[model samples]
Target chain A: SQTIHQWPATLVQPVGSPLSLECTVEGTSNPNLYWYRQAAGRGLQLLFYSVGIGQISSEVPQNLSASRPQDRQFILSSKKLLLSDSGFYLCAWRTSGNTGELFFGEGSRLTVL
Target chain B: AQSVAQPEDQVNVAEGNPLTVKCTYSVSGNPYLFWYVQYPNRGLQFLLKYITGDNLVKGSYGFEAEFNKSQTSFHLKKPSALVSDSALYFCAVRDPRNKLSFGAGTTVTVRA
Candidate 1:
């Protein structure tokens, strides 16, 4: 069975502080990974997606950035955090097939102080 | 290029009653639509999807969706609502690149 893991589960960071959220998938190889953010617990906004290592496509323009160093490891980072950056971050992955449903991680909650 | 819309911000239903979450979408080609559910402070769980063939698609947790191509709508339904069914629901459309475009989401509250 495939599973996705994301961390840190919860974080409280001050403004201008650096941020890093990691996600990794197990039981799959060369899967498609994605990063999404939910603001105010409502709509989901796509942040970034990677089809393969070192290949990331950004959907929204923001201070946040994503990197896929390994086939199953994806990292989301920001040099300086802002108050508006606080939200629930979700990590998901889909098999590298024509038709595969996405699987999600537990999620990471960031509260920018 | 492909997008989805969940018009209602919230839906309230009594337990044992039918539940429906409406969704409409637009796409240039054949649509690949999906439904997901989210609990508070958790990740979105895949419920169902509509690619082709049958107009009615059944999914996890006794939930199903009807794909109406004529109306460009895919509405999630449950024969009987439960308190556990209260959560946030999202509708999505997948583009050719396999990127999913999600709707604004609708909050469902199944009262006891």
Candidate 2:
């Protein structure tokens, strides 16, 4: 079975601080990885998605960026955090096909102050 | 240009009663619909998906969704609602490139 792991489970960051959130999938190779953010009272928004290593498609233009260092390792990063950046970030993976089903990780809660 | 609409922001249902959360979608080509559940502070969980074949698709946790192509709607339904079912439900539509466009989400509150 494939499992997605994301950390740190929760984080408190100051304004203008750097941010880094890591996601890794075990038991699957060359999977499609995605980064989504859920704001208060809102649905999940796709931030970035990668079909392969070093290839990322960004959905929204924001302070956040994503990178796929390895086949199953994805990272979301920001050089400087903003108050609006605070939200629940989720990492998801799906098989490399047209299937729309995605498996999500536990999620990471970031509180920017 | 794929979009999903969850008309209701919140739904209140009594336990043991039948529950329904409405969802409608718009897509240029064939629509691929899906339902997901999110608990407080937790990630979204895939409940069901409607790719093809059966209009009535059954999924995790005894939840089911009916895909009405004529109506352009895929509504999530449960015969018996439980208190544990209280959470946020999201409707998503898949684009040609396989990217998912999500709706605003509907919060379901099952009262005891």
Model 1 lDDT tens row, B62-107: 9999999899999999999999999999999998788888999999
Write the residue-wise lDDT of candidate 1 on A1-113 in tens digits: 88899999999999999999999999989999999999999888889999999999999899999999999999999999999999999999998875656889999999999
Compose the digit string of candidate 2's lDDT tens values, residues A1-113: 88999999999999999999999999988999999998894788999999999999999999999999899999999999999999999999998875788889989999999
Off by over 4 Å in 1: none
Candidate 1 chain B lowest-lDDT run of ten: B93-102
**TM-score for each candidate, following the candidate numbering:** 0.98, 0.98
Candidate with top DockQ is 2
Clashing pairs in 1: none
Q: What C-alpha lDDT, on a 0 to 100 scale, does residue B111 get in candidate 1?
A: 90
